[model samples]
Target chain A: MSEKLATAPRGKVSLFGVLRSESIRFFSLNSTRILILLAIVLYAAIAAIGTWGIGSLRASMGGMEQMPGMEDLAAPGFASELMGSGLVFSQLILGVLGVLLFSGEFTTGSAVSTFLASPQRLRVLAAKTILITVVTAGVQIVSSLLAFAISKPIADNYQMDLDFGSDAFQRVLWYGALAVAMAALIGLALGMMLRNSAGGITSLAALFFVLPIILSILTSITDWAQHIAKFTPDQLGMALATPSSVVTDLESWQQLLGVAGWIVLPLALGAVLLAKRDIK
Target chain B: MIQAQQLTKKYGGKTVVDNASFTVQQGMVTGFLGPNGAGKSTTMRMIVGLAAPTSGEVLVNGRDFKKSRHPLTEVGTLLEAKSVHKSLTPLAHLRAMAATAGLPVSRVHEVLEVTGLSSVQRKKVGGFSLGMGQRLGIATALLGDPQVLILDEPVNGLDPEGVAWVRNLARQQAAEGKTVFISSHLMSEMAQTADHLIVIGRGRIMADAPISEFIDNGLDQTIVRSADIEVLMNALNGDGVQLRRIDEHGVEVTGPDSVTIGRRALEYGVVLSELRPLQRTLEDAYMELTRDAVEYHSSNVAETGGGK
Candidate 1:
């Protein structure tokens, strides 16, 4: 016990240092890998089944343009847009991953060790924000690509067009990742603010699952509700990737800015609370 | 050196630690002794900036610890043994901490081996026993090879052998000139491990002195035994002196210093066989100072008295 430590001396704490710590700690847990795998597989499986069902239905309809409920299935870009039909589930799964990324430290009492190691509270938050952003964005992109790869052949078998290079396909692939990342960032913010896993996940569900339906009902009653709904985390993510879903004409850049606002506001608020509150 | 200048912490409307101030110097183990809920853990938390003090400040080596570039190297703190995620293995936990301080993985294994946790380093911490958790916590405190070590209740769940190891580790670190501050409610543990003792009761500093000075600071009592005990007792008695005859051959004397009583014994020439200064154990001194500080006393004291 009295022997000198043989390891090399360490330098000061930096952003990269904290990031390296968060990455190692994040990956070492089995739950992180399991969540990422489930998100990808669940997204691709849903996309494939939905594409097959729609393709088979369109094939059986001897067609004379007589179908009323299948109007969305007839759109030129419907295949690409349908590839992200499971984005909501991905958002739920990856968003919980983001929540665990921050809330785990508080829940397990490890905030004491983490804050002691770094001492700067806001720096820890900044590192976690970057970590979840990169991870969720990367995971969502892979899940989208996989979903498209699996769903395209089924649509092609039914004489339906599923082009990868279309403008709508590119939007769903790229902006869909951005939207998933937005949901994840919101979850991260909720986790930091609440500092409890159950509370953070429940509130995240309220935001993505409950609030969207509430707003959709209100939009039917008032035009002002539609304006506010467009900027919500769910709507911003959706409209940015699938522009055909919106009734209002929103420029691509404006949708991007809306996504940016949803991501920034919650994180900024969470950071302020993190810096102010004491670590128990 | 570590200093807390009027460090005050209040939670809601309750004051947990009230204007506590002390300086812990380097090159010795300074024991922080207090009763349960006496603000020892709160004070330790403030030192490392884990719990923000409502007012005043705590400094490490003359600067705000939170501003230090090398925080882990400056201070290795173990505020609680359970400061870890339940699902994480000890190896993963220490690796993360080492990475934050830019320390290599080799250092993590070194501390684990030293703390006797290498065999179980990869095991999940959730299933660790109380003593094993403490060893892992100590392993983390040793990870940075820090200059200042602040541990709160480090030996709470250790066996006798593990207890001895902690004592040796504390002394060994202090021998290297690092500032070692350890807190515990057990006086016997502190008595054996600490060189200087700073006692607190009810969030107030009750005593601060060297270990020797603390024991000697209590009422001066001497034991004198002789064939002619009555003659020695008469010579030892004086204003403010209380004498109790313990046996036919011995008497207990208090109020005067041992030197004065020795001189009087020599002057009387009562053929004294033994004139010994009664050295107070740290337990005795601590119990005397904190008699009013035992929180959650039994409602019926007589029923529980001497039951243990």
Candidate 2:
């Protein structure tokens, strides 16, 4: 046994190796697979339903020019906007996935194994970040494509334009993926910070859902609140993916900066805490 | 070899591991013996860089383990049973761990076979019994075929056969010049497997020595009972010999073996009904050393007999 151990080939830990490790474990669990499937199905279903709703609304109104206070909904890009109508739900689901990716390690005591193997805590965090990013972005892009595939026929029935080559549709497809990836990364940061699955998920929900409602209420009374509301994760996502659906005065660069903030700040704080605190 | 220099860890205001300094040598199984909450797990965590020490530092193979590039190959640690995701199978967990070190997938299969976890490798860890979980933990630690092995409470829930297997594994690893450091509260287990023993209690190092020296440090104690115990005591009285009266006819003899006492008794023609040697077990020595250091002493158990 000793001789066998001595002769066995040993390997070193590299960033690429840890990333592979994260992916291996990430793909092995039933939760990950279920979450991804649920996100895709729910996202596509919402988008398809949205396309039918808009098409039926426009058909009943006689024509796009007949709609009076809903000009944004009658725009040529509205059909594409329907493809990302479920972006919020997709964000929540994939964000929860991100939270679990990190929180599960601590909640299940697997951080002991992970950290012991790699030692450098930041490397593990970086690997998880990359894994979740690729995964959420990939899942979001697939969901958007599936939504488009199902919604195109519904839009055609109502003579609504759902052209795949339109700039607005491309934005919804690509930026929608970016929006979901952003939420997932935020969830990842919360997971690393809280180290509890429930707490991380709750925090992610509050950031995406509750906080936006609260900010909207505060925006009515306060000028600062209005400015902050434009930078809220929900608004930032909508502004980037379907800008016509959510009116905002900020330029594209400014909206992109806001998205970067949502992605970077929480992760930076989480990485700091993860590196400084004990794993137990 | 692992060296800890004044390693200390404090949780909030309470010091869990207080300034402990000890070295675990290679080529021998070193046992870390302590009661529950004695900071054995915390110390092991600190050694592998899981838990950061409040003060001081620990080095594995002469460098900080936190900075180790080839961590798995340098030191393999099993801090707790089931340090794994419940949703994962043993095969998945091992493969993931092995991937971190770029180790071959075959090594994962090898460790599973060695730990006797091949049959349940595909089973989810959530349903595993405590013993099975422990086996999985051991399998993970051996995944790297590491040069240094640190296992805490390795036999907490193992069967007799499993326990024996771990004992043999530790010995075999040490024989191959690998550093084997195991922590346990079971003194009997340590007595059989460890060549060197480091005893800790209440977060303090109580004793560090060889297994032989640990049991042999105390003087020889023998309990002699006879109607003519007075004659035996008188005959055995000499340099390094101390005799204490247990009863009117019984005397506890110290500093001489039973054979010597028998010889002296024969010379004195003493009629002795009992000449029993009181052997100092590892348990007794450990209890003696950590008498005042037990964190949560069992009031009923400690108060009843001799107050262990």
| Best prediction by TM-score | 2
Give one digit per residue, the lDDT tens place, for model 1 in A122-195.
88888998999999999998998898888888988987778899987898889888888888998999999999
The alpha-carbon deviation from the true structure for residue B64 of candidate 1, after best TM-score superposition, in angstroms, is 0.7
- Report the C-alpha lDDT of model 2 over A1-280, residue by residue, as the tens digit: 1223434476889999999999999999999999999999999999899878877877776756655777776688988988988999999999999999999999999998999889999999999999999999999999989999999999899888899999999999999999999999999999999999999999999988999899889978888998988998888998899988877899999999999999999999999999999888
* Clashing residue pairs found in predicted model 1: none
Give the DockQ (2 decimals) of all models.
Answer: 0.65, 0.69
* Residue B20 miss distance in model 2 (angstroms): 0.9
Evaluate model 1: give its TM-score.
Answer: 0.93
Residue-level lDDT of model 1, residues B125-212, one tens digit each, is 9999988988888888888888899999999889988888888889988998999999999899898999999998888888888999
> What tier of docking accuracy does candidate 1 attain?
medium
**lDDT of model 1 at residue B4?**
93
Give the fraction of true interface contacts kept by model 1: 0.75
Q: What is the lDDT of residue B296 in candidate 1?
A: 47
Candidate 2 local lDDT, B1-308, one digit each (tens):
99999999999999999999999999999999998889999999898888899999999999999999889888878888989999999999999999998999989888888888898999999999999999999888888888999999999899998998889999999998999999999899999999999999989999999999988889889988888887878788899899899889998888988999988888999878998989899999988888888888876665688654
Give me the candidate number with maximum lDDT: 2
Q: What is the Cα-based lDDT of residue B298 in candidate 1?
A: 57
